[model samples]
Target: MRVKCTVSYDGTGFSGFQIQPGQRTVQGEIERGLKKLHKGQEVKVFASGRTDAGVHAIGQVLHFDTEIYIPESRWPNALNSLLPEDVAIQAAAFIEEDFHARYHVRAKEYRYKVSRSEVRDVFSRNYAYHYPYKLDYVKMREAIKFLIGTHDFTSFCSAKTDKEDRIRTLYDIEFYEEDDVLTFRFVGDGFLYNMVRILVGTLINAGRGVLDPYRIPDILKARDRSLCGKTAPGSGLYLWKVYYDN
Candidate 1:
């Protein structure tokens, strides 16, 4: 039987979502938990997206094939008993055999957090980017408009990307502030490696007067990595949600 699971993890201690040869990863931990339930069998799991090291996820979706039978109500507790404190299985259910976590995903939402206060909060150090500069929220919002449709996101993607096609459709990009936190939310069909972080960095530069908001279009047209801002810290990024057609 195939099962779909919704997971949430505090990625502070994880290498990333995908399993590396010898590194600690969210997939490795979950696979171990599954192995505990199904003795002597290797479990394969698929995730909606692969998060970078130190990047967290609140609504990560995944699927796995297993022969062991466990009630959906007991799935969370069963997995939690064998998993680490930072990783939790929020829910699980029987899914169609054809359902795939990655291929079936319709859209994904990512939020980048920035601290606008002069004094940084120690508690939020792992969850937000502490910036001492005063940001112009209006200008940031204006800059985001240029990113709200399909475009060649080559400039925003890291040079290490292996994909040849750089075109991506951004459904929506918005900027808002609440208290001392400035939030940048991006919903897209898909994202390239480090795309969101680079986008946030560029927006930060615009907010800090380092880059003019009106130049956003020109930057996108340039398709040059050097013309964009630095990639924002992974600590400030979160995979907020993933939408599926079915």
Candidate 2:
């Protein structure tokens, strides 16, 4: 049977989502619990995408196959018992045999949080990026508008990325500010490695008045990695949501 699950995790203590030999990872933990469920039989969990190290997730989706019969409603409780405290199975359902977690995705939303307060938020140190510098939010919003359609995102992707085709469709980019917290949400059909982080870094540069908002188009047209700004910390990023059609 193919089982679909929605997962949430605090990525502070994890190496990353994918399995890395000699490292403790979210996939490793989930697979461990799944093996216990199958009485030591191994199972592989396929996620929609990999979140870089230190990136949290509010709604991550994955699917796995198993021969054991466990009620879908009880998957969370059963799996949570075996998994570590930081990782959790939020929801689960039986899916069609051919349903795929990665290829079937329609779009994904990623959120980056920045604390604008001058005071250090010790409690939120592991959760958000602290940027006390005065930000020109108005200019940042204007810059984001230039990235709201299909384009080659090579400038924003990491140099270490293995992806060959950099073309991607960005559905929208929105910014919100309340109190001392500034947030940005990016919705796209798919993302290349470190794409969202690099995009946010460039936008933040615009906010800091280091880069002109209108120059974003030229950067995109350049298609050069050097044209992008510094990449944002993974701690400030979250896998906000994964969308799929029923």
Q: Highest lDDT: which candidate? A: 2
Candidate 1 lDDT tens digits, 1-246? 989999999989999999998899999999988887888577989999899999999899999998888898888898889999999999998989999999999999999998878888898898999997877777888888888899999999999999999999999998778988988899999999999999999998888889999998998999998899999999999998999987
Candidate 2: lDDT of 62?
98
What is the TM-score of candidate 2? Answer: 0.98
Worst 10 residues of 2 by lDDT: 120-129
**Model 2 stretches astray by more than 4 angstroms:** none
> Against the hidden reference, what TM-scores do the models get?
0.97, 0.98
User: Judged by TM-score, which candidate is best?
Assistant: 2
Q: Which ten residues in a row have the lowest lDDT in candidate 1?
A: 132-141
For candidate 2, write residues 113-161 as lDDT tens digits. Answer: 9988899788779889998888888889888889899999999999898
Candidate 1 backbone collisions, by pair: none
